[model samples]
Target: MSSTPTDARLMDGSGLARRLVEETAARAADLTRRTGTPPCLATVLVGEDPASVTYVRMKRARCEKAGIRSRHVELPATTTTAEVVATLEGLSNDPEVHGILLQHPVGPGIDERAAFEAIAPEKDVDGVTFSSFATMSFGLPGFVSCTPGGIMRLLDAYGVDPAGKRAVVVGRSAILGKPAGMMLLARNATVTYCHSHTADLSAAVREADILVAAVGRPRFIKGEDIKPGAVVVDAGYNPGNVGDVDFDTAVTRAGLITPVPGGVGPMTIAVLLAQTVDAAERQLA
Candidate 1:
């Protein structure tokens, strides 16, 4: 029933994320002052997928910038799932390590779920464990999946309350899509989850007052399908820095839309660093 009055306003995710990181930095400094131990985050990477290496490097850099400490463990591509689990379990038992992040898609053969479960729920700063999901789903106090947590923060920053909106999440990945829908639902949005198999995807998309596209495909959510005046969040980051929602077309129809590079991407790291600090403080306390 509603329509956009003009071209969609771009959501300033990078700006918001910068502010968030600054706040987290302050908290990190406080923790350091109080405990003589700077918040430490342990990042585990399997193999040297060029992309994963770059990501870990970036994360370490961010942790340093935020006044948090970083420890990295690199495992070979040939390492078995059992080895990965043992490594994670070791980190979990280490008192000095407050937060643990196991880089995703560990490799072709490793059992990612088993590796994730090896992390103690208290140190699950990456929010990969089942305990994290259960807590996130119920709006309880616990760590959240970073990307989804960032999405909620973005929504809050933009003053887009989800209390009565119709939210459609177009993906079902365990870390991103599923958690995102649960987040919106917890905020009282009427939530629908659509994936690669959804029938009449366009119809479902058009009905959304809030649209979250996390399908990791480049421009999969077309402009024509966007509902006018709807708030659009494109969480996809495929090659070429493209998002699931087509910015070119969707911008004209949406009231608010997130650009691929400066939008959800920056927020993801911001939330991760913030959560790392959170875990550290809790453990230190």
Candidate 2:
């Protein structure tokens, strides 16, 4: 029996992120006008890693464009875990700061989780804290990990409901994979997680109605693994602007697929700004 061919749709995350950023800018302006204080996002960078620096710079530029203020905290490469925690605690207590974002991979020596825990749950706009994870898992009203939150938003924009769908998340990192799975679970998707150690990764992926590739390895998910008509969300950002999934071939099979540069990257920052505004609004209330 010959199966009907599927014409895949490109999920335009860039377009959606643009609209979201515009809305966030307007809301930010309104909030500032009413409260006499602009929403402020505090960015904490542990080292001078070129990539991390660039990411923070981009975030600050976006905040400025959105009428939000930014407070930057730069630390030495050799900063200890306790020192990182102290800095975050300071930002957490600062009433002028509405949100806090700590750039990930704060070098090998530091205890990352301890530093993440230092940020107050209310100020954790990047949604890296355990509190945010729990809230997202339970479908509670709280900040969510920006990338996962953005993925959900994209799904909503494309009118793809996660309810009762099989979602296969490749990777189990705290910020990306784990949170993505939890968010899908909250939306009533039957979620499965696969990692480096999973046997038959391709088999797991082929079962997905919705596939989220966030394993951070370039072209790690092959096209043959993709189920026909599945919604594919590529959240990986590897070197040379490559995604975890092989987009070239996956696009042919996926009902909807997100491109690398224009997909999950833009949405991540858009969600951050939106959550920052939300944090400010809550503080004002």
Q: Show the colliding residue pairs in model 1.
A: none
TM-score of each candidate structure, all chains considered together: 0.97, 0.97
Residue-by-residue lDDT tens digits, candidate 1, 7-122: 68888899999999999999999999999999999999999999999999999999999999999999999999999999999999999999999999898899999999999999
Tell how far residue 240 is off in model 2, in angstroms: 1.3
- lDDT for position 51 in model 1: 95
Against the true structure, candidate 1 reaches a TM-score of 0.97
Q: How well is each residue in 179-255 modelled by candidate 2, as lDDT tens digits?
A: 99998998899999999999989899999999999998999999888999899999998998889988888887999
Cα lDDT of all candidates, in order? 0.93, 0.94
Q: Could you give the C-alpha RMSD of every candidate to the true structure, in order shown?
A: 2.8, 3.2
Lowest-sum lDDT 10-residue window in model 2:
1-10
Task: Please list all clashing residue pairs in model 2, or write none if there are none.
Answer: none
